[model samples]
Target: MSKYFAVLLLLIFSTQIQALEKVTLQLKWTHQFQFAGYYMAKEKGFYQEEGLDVIIVPADPNNPNVDFRVLYGQAQFGVFHSGLLKQRLEGKPFVALAALLQSSPYCWMVKAQSGIYVPRDFQGKRISLLGHTENGELLMMLQRAGVNTDSMLLYSGKKPFDDFIAGKFDAMQVYSTNEPYQAQQLGVATREICPKQFGLNVYADVLFTTEAMLRDRPQQVMRFRRASLKGWRYAMLHLEESLAVTKANYATHKSLAQLAYEAEKLKDFIRVSGIPIGKMSAAKWLWIAQLYHLDVSQFHEHKADFIYSEVKQDPASLSWVLIIAAVLTLVCIPMYIQLIFSRKNKSHLR
Candidate 1:
């Protein structure tokens, strides 16, 4: 009897241990303070506490295609640019889980004394950007300012800012956190031209997952977001602790000073004055789609409950009066008949 009881207990323990659902997350770029929230969540046992065994994977620096990892079965979730909407517009089944960076940190950079102070100055200049993000917004800024790109020379490649500092180009696209710090270290004075200054709103660093994941495992999805946001809040409040956790576990080439600088600089990028973290408005998504000129006619989506969350939506009071179509047609028919009789009277008089 004792031996049978021991064997049954062992089988139950093994089954409970195996019950934890495993998922992998792919990061957009190489590991750094940029991904500190995820690192904090992992190190602080938040994922484990949620009954998740998350495997965090960093992209190869040479190949930083993050969305495809989530789109395929290679990974269930990823942090990527809001430009993922372009793929979503194409009918791909990717659902945005959260907005990591409320504001985009991308801008055009040049030497401080390069005499290029405004978006208009980018006309007839050579420019290169690292990623596909914000490229459309940049062009729209120039176009709105009456700056022509016909004389513009563009290059799509990696690390163009180094070439920018070498005087191989007039201006290069840079993230406010990374390149400006590098230029400062190299004694290159760079003046960053921000898109927000030109009336462009961009969303960056979006967290997304597959439709299958969200649809099948909604409870786990909510758990992941809750824990991840908790991790982000802790990281922002405890910068040094988060950085220490990240650096100790993750491999990166950046020095301690560089990582620390990124941690401090990224706070502004992620935090808004009054908005909650991970909050996204449908207006923002629609504005981005408009900026990119994406045709979303097929989406047939609405603004209500646009973002996925566990919070119950408060019922909206009837703000709009429903106008009956039959009543509208009845009101217009008299005008239509009068116009036809008036035209007939004019014809008779002629």
Candidate 2:
């Protein structure tokens, strides 16, 4: 009977230990090559190795307020712009865990033969922009190039790339990773002008979580970060495997050439020194704060630390710090009880 009871207890404890830690990650956009690293991680069992079961939720265009949704605890983590994070962290508390892209991929592209060699050519031209943010960035870039945005006609909508190829717009703001590669695969030669060339360097695709999660479940966050960084490093190193994983996820957009081009571009973007993969710096945070016109003083007051520099450290340190502290307490607890009992006996004798 004693042997059976012991075996039953061990089984119960083993079952409890194998129960996976649940985490939810919200992507900034729909499934595409941009998020190939995360997909590769899931497909390759990296998250499982870290004892995590990660669920990736796609962002809804209709309900675009992922920041508030994440803040209210609808999700555990999210991928978004540092600008949006700066704005969201004003009153609400959130921490940036890692930056996927070292630099913004925002760029204006035109057909190579369109005679639109420079931004000045954009004056008196029609341009297609996806949203107001892209339009604003393009306008800023144009202004720097001495091209007045008022002089150009703006067409804003989500439409086919063929629209630009058919002379609908003289230029368009497309991701340096996506549309440009798609155009190249279609034999549509394009000239891309990165917005950063004009001194507009915004941080793109930042990973973040709520303050509550950080405080209450630091171990879970650490595990997730380590797994994600491993996934990112693998994706960066194994380009073909990463693209294969992405293609499996987004089978509708089939163009091996385009995927290859995007993978190469993204690799370059992620390799920049200032933008270490899965890390964030205080200087970058301050720069983002300034860009969004946020008060830096407020951040200094409630300052939440989210950057994980030790995310890639050895697995032993990944163990729960609180667990170690508890063990130390348990060891000292017996000595404390003995001291109390000894004092009580001496007082009774007196």
Candidate 3:
């Protein structure tokens, strides 16, 4: 009787272990309240309930990009922004399982005391951005307001708000949830201008995988999405607990108070559109496509047309700029040649 009972326990344990499906999810950035829902999901055993052994991977700047990790099978899924959707339209093999935020938290932040009240005020001003991520939205806002694109200057330096805080620039682009809150905490009065003001609001924070994954492992994809969305709903209702989980697992530079502030801001962004959390719409994708001036008709059949939008570069006058650059390079050739020769001669003499 004792031997039979021991065998039953071992069998039960092995069955439980075998039931859990192992998978990895790559976050778009470091661990913080930004990923509170995922943490809460794990903490609550939502993934386990779905028979998934979900591994949450934080993004490391020193490592390959999150998209590459997912593509190379290091991770089965990843969290990215609307930019991924745009890339998909432009020929990436990615497919989004969820739009984490109904509308983007992306917007332009400007010091209100600097006498710039609106998008029109951005003319001839230095606006710090996160690479070209939000440039399309900015240009669209400026164009709609008749602001001259040439007069505007964009600075894409890392941790961009440092200069802006010191009053070194006219305005800076930031997520509605993050930098604006930082500015407020530091007592810098600011205003935000979003794409929605000009009818160009796009979705943000997508959980995605490759098209091949959807083709080959559709059930797994569905299970992951359902589990993640469920986790988000639970996190939304239990903000403090979810945040505590985030703080415990992923050390953040932010104070609990600051994270709380972000939590509130995130809640607003997630539910602002009155859509269910993790929902996407065809109209929103269509709007972003129009912002980039892509062919909307071609959007009909591509998964992109149904799933996302085509984001392209701005149509500013590149020809004249290229011509001037070529002329300048031609004139600088002799100087460059002399400098190179001088450096080489100096090295040899030494």
Best by TM-score: 1
lDDT measured at residue 73 in model 2 versus the true structure, 0 to 100:
87
Off by over 4 Å in 3: 1-10, 61-65, 156-159, 304-350
Candidate 1 matches the true fold with a TM-score of: 0.80
The sequence of per-residue lDDT tens digits that candidate 1 reaches over residues 1-350 is 35544655565545445655798989988888888888888789887666678888989867776788888879988888867777776767777778888877777888988889998888888887445654567667788899887668877655576677878888777777788899989988878887777778677778888778877777777777777888888888889888787777884577788888887777887888887877887778888777777765533362232345564431211111122233335545765787799899999999
Residues 1-350, model 2: lDDT tens digits = 35544655565445435656788888887666777778777788888766678898877767655777678888898887755555545556777788888678888888898888766778888887556342345566677789877767877756747788777787888788878877876888899877677676667788878779877777777777778878888888888888887877663466766677777787776777655686667777776666555787865654445444434454434454444455546645765687799899999999
Better of 1 and 2 by TM-score: 1
Please give the CA lDDT of all the candidate structures: 0.75, 0.72, 0.74
- Highest lDDT model number: 1
Better candidate number, 1 or 3, judged by TM-score: 1
TM-scores vs. true structure, each candidate: 0.80, 0.76, 0.79
Name every residue pair that clashes in candidate 1. Answer: none
lDDT of 3 at 166: 83
Backbone collisions counted per model: 0, 0, 0
lDDT of 3 by residue, 1-350 (tens): 35544655565556556767899999977777877888878889888766689999889845525788887888999988766756766777888777887666678888787777777877778877545453467667777888887666767666578888987777777767678888888988998888766666677778888877777766677777778989999999888888777777764666788778778878976776557888877777676777677667755556552362222432222433464455546646765687799899999999
Pairing residues by index, what is the TM-score of model 3? 0.79
